[model samples]
Target: MKRYRQFEPVLISGFKILEWTHPEHNHNHYEFIFIREGTGRHIVNGHSFPYKAGSIFLLGPDDQHYFEIEQLTHFVYLKFTDAYLCRNSSGSTSAIQQLEYLIKSRETHQMGFQLVGEDNAIITLIFDTLLLLRKDQIVNQELIWFQLFTVVHVLQRNMPELRSNSFKSRDLQAMFCYIHKNIYDPNRLRI
Candidate 1:
């Protein structure tokens, strides 16, 4: 029932766990979690599923989840605030819009990623690359931005329902994001 808060735009950290430290919880930001090694049941939004190594999943601000570790689990979390997405949006608006589309459409992506074989390897590689880029405090913002987009690109290619042709138009996605962010402001919501 608790919701965690994150002030930073992006953070990458990993740890091994015998059991989850928190109870069922959601976050103020979004989280992209990779199960580097382990076996467990991921109880997400009341839906439970088994996960092992290479189990990748995403959780938006409103999604509630917790892990039931059946064996020792190593979790690498790539957490980012919505502000991260907004700030990271360079000139290419479509990609960010598409990602926002996925984030808002809970039924489409809340369960996370069910990847395997080469796909698993590729994602692991991307995350590993990100881990390295994030260390030593010499982080290249552009490079990190690109790699994060790559992860989103990979997710876009794999989620059949979110095929490029089927994605909401760029302007529509933008409007939705705009509206969602300014929901409390009547002036901002006005056309």
Candidate 2:
């Protein structure tokens, strides 16, 4: 019910050392949250899940969430909007659109991905590098955009495969595939 709306296109990335407190809230912008350290539970849209260091959660505008921080935590959030993604005609519109669809279609209001195993090292490295640039007030917009895009792509690629518990028939599978394939064209999807 609470919506945090920002009109301007922006990319905000930062690290926060926090107390055991997080407000329950929702936003108009998209959020990619990475837990740098500590332990807690993240509750989104009534779904509760435990979280620890390396936990990552992606949220769209429709989700409402908050955290029960059990310990002192370090949080990193990459907040952006579609306007930000399209701020420049970098020929990335289609890719961003796909990423948006992926984010929306995947698990909602829960841990989208965990920065574990090989992902731990790679994501940490990228996070650290980006944090440094941010701290220094670097003006490398292109680099920042690309790095954040990479992070989104990683999350999308790591998302769990959709489970079709309702439709077990091969016809359902074909129908689902066809729907996805024609998602971009309204006329094709209608037919």
Candidate 3:
């Protein structure tokens, strides 16, 4: 299996093709894949999930995936490095720890994000704005981070509700709820 390496901090790119040319591969950076159009099965770690226009997938560094296209597919990828995520917390070790805890959670991977309901419009707008700013080479760092964080919060909020059995311990469950409940308030989520 091939493992891809990304040298850039962030990247937003789009393409349309009738077939998936790349083999199943994992990358060093995190990825948000937006299915702009078409239909297909997205195979991730040997699991296949059907996808159509507006489907969005979040891939962590360890995830291996590829598309099995059934129709012409249009893809837009938002890739970013860990450094980009933790850039705001220059010297805060807990920031990185918290990021790794939430982002690397195995359960989160099981619930692939969607482009559904009101979130559909919000996410679409963010992507469109980011793409336009990226094209113009005039991205406002704060605005980009704000948009990305907003997307993350939306994903968190919409995650399927977990029962007591879902978590190993009561404390863990509480932490999860507290963290997600106050996601927009950084001070409240500080570890």
Candidate 4:
């Protein structure tokens, strides 16, 4: 098993798994899983989806989810706290807000999203950015922000059904507060 610790608030790691088993549980930080290759059964909030290549799973804070991977699998995961997302500029903040909306909509509606076509290239960039962020060097926050923006932009481009411009600043703040306060509660946000 491999683990990573965050000294700078966000942790990004990649894994190529021959075999993997995760205990049924949830986390306090937001999790983005980009599957480069594999097939599996993903069980999230009692809904199970067949996981395949190009599957992107976004698990918001404390969203009960786990996976059973059968056969070889390669994926990149990025985990970051809400505080980190909130620290960036308005556009970055809006992107994170959209992500939150997607997660909530996924959980509430039991919807799963798959990245296709040019979206794959954008996801690859996000993986590359994670690798760059791992190096022991003074990282340029602006560059990372740009990479993050690219990821969100691709997501927004590909998943227009999940996109919404109705989110306001107060809604973003309330969502963050709700996530922090009810992170461990499974019944907190029922569609």
Candidate 5:
């Protein structure tokens, strides 16, 4: 298991042209991948799924994956960590905790989203905004947060099970405390 870590509290965004250069990899952070214009088969833990323009996939920590590109693909990736999600928390049910449940409970092999019709248009609009914002090196943290939340929320709306309100408050509180207290302590992190 490769544990790629992000030290800073910021969303990592990029556009890549696929040439089958990178091997299958899994990391410690959460990944939101959008296929901007491409045709490909996404391989997750040996299972294959077809993907095209507007395809969205969420890779949580430990979701091993790689892509088999069929057409020259333009892939966009948005990566972040729980620490970043928790940075602006104000209450018990925060984005980090919502994301914790969303990420940890999902099947590693599941493709997170499929775009269609109006949904496709709307998400693509948001995707374009995020790409533009990243390109300009803008410091609009609130917009970044909202955009990421919209992505996650859209995925949840598509998957009914993901929309379940099952996280208990005490658990979120405890998890928040544990994460904040030991974020810089690797030894404590190991526990």
Candidate 6:
């Protein structure tokens, strides 16, 4: 029941179709929402976007957002903290790279069409990770890190547009800082 924040990188929350409705105005940690079935509309920063199966929406820290379900939807919500991303894994920073790009993008960037065919695989992986996280089994940190990277890799491979711009460490840090400062107050974010 801990609220998500930048200090803790992962949160596993599940929602059924009937539970879908407007949230009581709050910010997010790094968020990944996967719609397994049905359809809905996501309202973020005054914009209403359509959400169907396989729809993946990424919300950075402090981003005020919510969803209204139009059909029966099954989804998993993952929220991770920024501090968790800064930790280096082996020699590669793929997780950091993926997270930086995801956070830098606009709130609610769609990944693919409804959760069908290949997209179902990604959804399954996400659900699997959520279950693993919930279990809290004693395991190597590296394994957990790799699991996180895999999620990012799946997302990037699925949505080429999200991987378009290469980012430097400083740029990503600055972007995250800006998001942290303005996400709660959408009026302050010009973009």
Of the candidates shown, which would achieve the greatest TM-score relative to the real structure? Answer: 1
In Å, residue 96's CA in model 6 sits off its true spot by 1.1
Q: What is the C-alpha RMSD of each candidate to the true structure, in Å?
A: 12.2, 8.9, 9.7, 13.5, 14.0, 13.9
**Most lDDT-accurate candidate:** 1
The sequence of per-residue lDDT tens digits that candidate 4 reaches over residues 73-161 is: 88788777777777765665577776666656654324455776777866876777776776642465666666655766676555654
lDDT against the true structure, per candidate, is 0.81, 0.73, 0.75, 0.69, 0.73, 0.63
Better of 1 and 6 by lDDT: 1
Candidate 2: lDDT of 107? 72
Residue 54 of model 6, lDDT score: 71
My TM-score estimates for the predictions, one after another, are 0.79, 0.75, 0.74, 0.70, 0.74, 0.66
Off by over 4 Å in 6: 1-8, 21-24, 88-90, 107-116, 137-144, 160-191
lDDT string, candidate 6, 65-100, tens digits: 677878888877766665556554446665677667
Candidate 1: clashing residue pairs, number: 0
**Alpha-carbon lDDT of model 2:** 0.73
Model 3, total clashes: 0
| Ranked by lDDT, top first | 1, 3, 5, 2, 4, 6
lDDT of 2 by residue, 22-127 (tens): 4677898888788888888888887888988888888888888888888877877777787887675478876686577667674734655675688777777777
lDDT of 4: 0.69
**Model 2 regions lying over 4 Å from their true place:** 17-22, 136-138, 162-191
Model 5 lDDT vs. the true structure? Answer: 0.73
Per residue, candidate 3 scores C-alpha lDDT tens digits across 99-153 of: 4555776655543666587888787777777777677433566666666666676
Better of 1 and 6 by TM-score: 1
